[model samples]
Target: MDYQFKLLRQSRQNLLRFTEQFTLEELNEVPEGFNNNIIWHMGHILVTQQLLCYKNAGVPCRISDEIINQFRKGTKPEALVPEEEVTFIRKRLTQTPSLLEEDFRNGLFGEYNEISTSFGNTISNIEEAVVFNNIHEGMHFGYLLALRRALTKTV
Candidate 1:
């Protein structure tokens, strides 16, 4: 397994477990002034997995175009996705890491295009993007924690 993939899996599992503590209402709550709900964040992470791996690897995504469009890099959270769909999304999240590994092994990786975000600098390879996304996901994990607090009125 690639070290980057391992990190992504670890973070992803942590995110899922963290999410499990919340009720559906809590997961769906946007919290005043926030851009998205917990469900959106979770979906976004999965969407990012494809964008950073399969799409960048020069292979088409195995997930649906509608999902890709909804969760892609810049998509916002205001879009309404049902709670049931969100729950199903969590299950689907389990399947992406292996697909990423497949892309890596099949030499499906393509040259990195520049990603302009808080991370800064142009990435020249998929490995760097993989590493960067770990940090990116962590940042969102922080948001998830905040959302949990906001929705549940708990610390």
Candidate 2:
């Protein structure tokens, strides 16, 4: 479990570095052929972590309902995100994994509810959720790399 948490932290660190390479405007711009912006991906990453871990386990999410509603599965960016909200998302992006690790160590998610995802996988426990979350985050990171290339018109 410690190794799982360590992987999550390293993944987030890499994501944070990738995000820092772009300007806020670049992060907010939706590439001509794309459905969302880089910032939207950031929000989605943050939202899905909470949904898969805390919300699925019947624990309250540390983030707001507004954030969850805006970036949850099946939602896309509807308008330009304010910088404050983007900052909040980035903040939580780095912070949530450690909090989850702490809570898990304390046995906070004893009754994790199993959920069958839209992608056809079920996460039945905290361990599975964490593993799935790492994969999900990596998918978004790859998409972010694609978004950056599109936005910059670079190979």
Cα RMSD (angstroms) for every candidate in the order listed: 2.3, 1.5
Question: C-alpha displacement of 88 in model 1, angstroms?
Answer: 2.8
Best-matching candidate per lDDT: 2
Q: lDDT tens digits, residues 1-155, model 1? A: 47888887888788888888877767767887688888888988887777766676566877888888887767776656777788678887877777677777887786666566556665567787677678778998998887876776643
Candidate 2 wrongly placed segments (more than 4 Å): none
Instruction: Compose the digit string of candidate 2's lDDT tens values, residues 6-71.
Output: 999999889888899887788889888998888888889889999899999999998999999998
Q: For candidate 2, give the lDDT of residue 133.
A: 94
Off by over 4 Å in 1: none
Q: Cα RMSD for candidate 2?
A: 1.5
Where does the lowest 10-residue lDDT sum fall in candidate 2? 146-155
